[model samples]
Target: MTQAFDIIIVGAGMVGAALATGLGQQGIRVGLIDKAVPADFDAHASPDIRVSALSAGSERYLQSLGAWPALVAMRATPYRRLAVWDETPHPLSRLLPGSLTEVEFNAAQLGADHLGHIVENSVTQNALWQTAQAQPDVTLMTGQGLTSLEQSPDCARVTLEDGTELSAQLIVGADGAMSQVRTLAGIGVTRDQYQQQAMVISVRYLGPPEDITWQGFFPSGPRAFLPLHGAGDQHPDETWGSLVWYDSPARLAELKALSDAQLMAEIGKSFPDRLPHLTHIDAKASFPIARQHAKHYFLNRVVLAGDAAHTINPLAGQGVNLGFQDAQCLQGLLKEARRSGDDLANPRWLGQYEQQRRPANRRMMLAMDLFYHLFSNQIPPVHLARNLGLGAARALPFARNRVARYAMGLDEQLPGPVQQILHRLPGLNRI
Candidate 1:
């Protein structure tokens, strides 16, 4: 069978589905194909779970695409404050010298009142799917795996595993780390695996529904607390955020096997020196984490976006945020090219897309790696350096502001009104 659309997005995950919805609004026809439907129940359960943090940029873009409203009804929770610290043991040298040993971050010092919203993976996905289904030009094709791809001067020919064929001006690879579409387009990946794996477990908080996000880095990784609705000062039984607990795979397996009460006891061992509220909660599930990136985001008519393009460490929950930026840049690029009467499939334009995104992706990857290594190091010199670094960050307001803006997606060259408001929020004075 032969059919056609303006664009064919190979993976209909958050980033891909958002792009489809955005392009559809601009009167472009789209074909969104995914391997599986979002589950009928909570998508982020144990073993095979799904979850993502939606940055303000991402949330605004989704709202513009009419995808955020549906998720707001489900597991989406907002956080206005964030606290971060490195848990590396301070060397005796620092204590003798009267130097500070701890580094902390407060989100209010960032440009926004809230960092972003945390929503269950399927909550966001199903919302986009429901919105996408109503568009006459947006065709939803589930469980349709790519079988083959053929490239010509004008367009790419694509065949599904079910024996369906289509030709489109652009084919977008929004697939996960292992992107078949990127492979089919002859794209290469520049990847490095981290030594540790993050076992993200959902938790039922036994205490207050907190509005603040807390994270403390350890010799192993970071243990983060996300506030879900649970018993708080204002409301009782006000459950709140998911706890993203990072650990080595071997240790994670051992932790996963213990009874609920026993597992909670084991968790308490990590933070006995600090906050242990979240550690005492009941665990939902766990998974291994990896870092992956495509060498280039675009090649000819085929382009990679989201995790297909780059997957960073999740210590700070920036993976989906980066993917959102990719989607925006891509949608804007296509829109701008069309306005200039240039072919969207032109290699020159695709090259420009790669140029703009590759450096940014690389920077984030390195930043995460550095944080993971230096803070987790037990070596006395590196440990002292981390303490010094954290102390410097705490006192340097201008530097803190710059880092905060970068984290909030509000650099000197922000894109739209939504971002401008986020950057200009008065609460950032806390920096």
Candidate 2:
């Protein structure tokens, strides 16, 4: 039997599930397919090692999809302050004050209640899954993997591993960076792997949950801190936090081999002094970082969103936020398409989506890559230049706030100066 839908979205992760929910709310028949279901939330379990910093704009989008309340009910930590500073030591560093070397954004100063929320990836996925499932127009095909994809002049179709066939006016590839749907749809990506790999550690600290998150940049890479929820009665007076240590593969491998106690000691010595006293190591994992962008956002009846479209450095915690932006953009376009009584795969709307999103995604990728390259370089001139840049940002409040607002998705355009910098960056035409 053939299952028909207005659209079939592959990969029911954050972006796909949210899209399904949004489209369903508009009365669009959607098939949300994924091989694995999000794990049920458990209050007593340790925090998921994989987490994302959801920006305020992303919060509003999720709230519109009816997932934010469920996420808060499960667990979400809002950070009112975000700080980034240069930690690399140099003989010239003694000349500058600590305040000049660091730039912090406060919610109060920005006229916002909180900057963003640090959420476990599982909790977010589960919340979106629940919201998606509640949509009467959405059919969630979980535990079924996509095996094949086919497209005709009229529509696109996909086959599951169990031989169940589904057809829709459009097939969306939201499966992620290594997207099978992307491959099946014949889209290619340009990928550049970074020298440093990020190792994330989930641990409990001896303090209440924190309202701030910070990252210290080094020659190797940036080490970051994201505060999670508090520990339960089993460990009274403790809170959970996530730490990211980015370094060479060999160095992270050595740290990964250490016992819990040994790793904790090493973390104390290596991470910024501001890290709270960690009480227990719950889980740890590491993966290589890369900048990837799809050559095209759509091909014929198949379209891409989220990680399927692009992936950027995780330094700023903007990956999932970008994905959410993609979902929101595509959802709006699809709604417009339905209103016009056009095929959901109409290139007119899909082209507009790519046109609006590509530059935005590319700009973010370049910005992150700029930070990655600038901070990772050890050349004295580069180091001094970056420090001066940070100092200038702190010294100039208006420009600093403008950049911050752009990053927070509160502003649509990157400031003129920043846009010019991105434009002049080498190899700008390629990415």
Cα lDDT tens digits for candidate 2, 1-431: 99999999999999999999999999999999999955788898888899999988899999999999999999999999988777877665677555545668888987989988999999999999999999999999889888889999998889998999999999989998899999998899998887889999999999899899988888788999999998989988999999999999999999999999999999999989999999999889998888899999999999999999998889888888999999999999999999999999999999999999998999888776554544445654334344435334333334434554565454667776666555544655677
Error of 2 at 41 (Å): 1.2
- What digit string (tens of lDDT, one per residue) describes model 1 on residues 79-123? 776655556665543443222233344457765677777676777
Rate residue 289 of model 1 by lDDT.
69
Would you estimate the TM-scores of all the predictions? 0.83, 0.94
What TM-score does candidate 1 reach? 0.83
After superposition, the stretches of candidate 2 with alpha carbons farther than 4 Å from their true spots are 373-376, 380-412
Instruction: Count clashing residue pairs per candidate.
Output: 12, 0
Q: Cα-based RMSD of the predictions, in order?
A: 7.1, 2.5
Question: TM-score winner among the candidates?
Answer: 2
RMSD of 1: 7.1
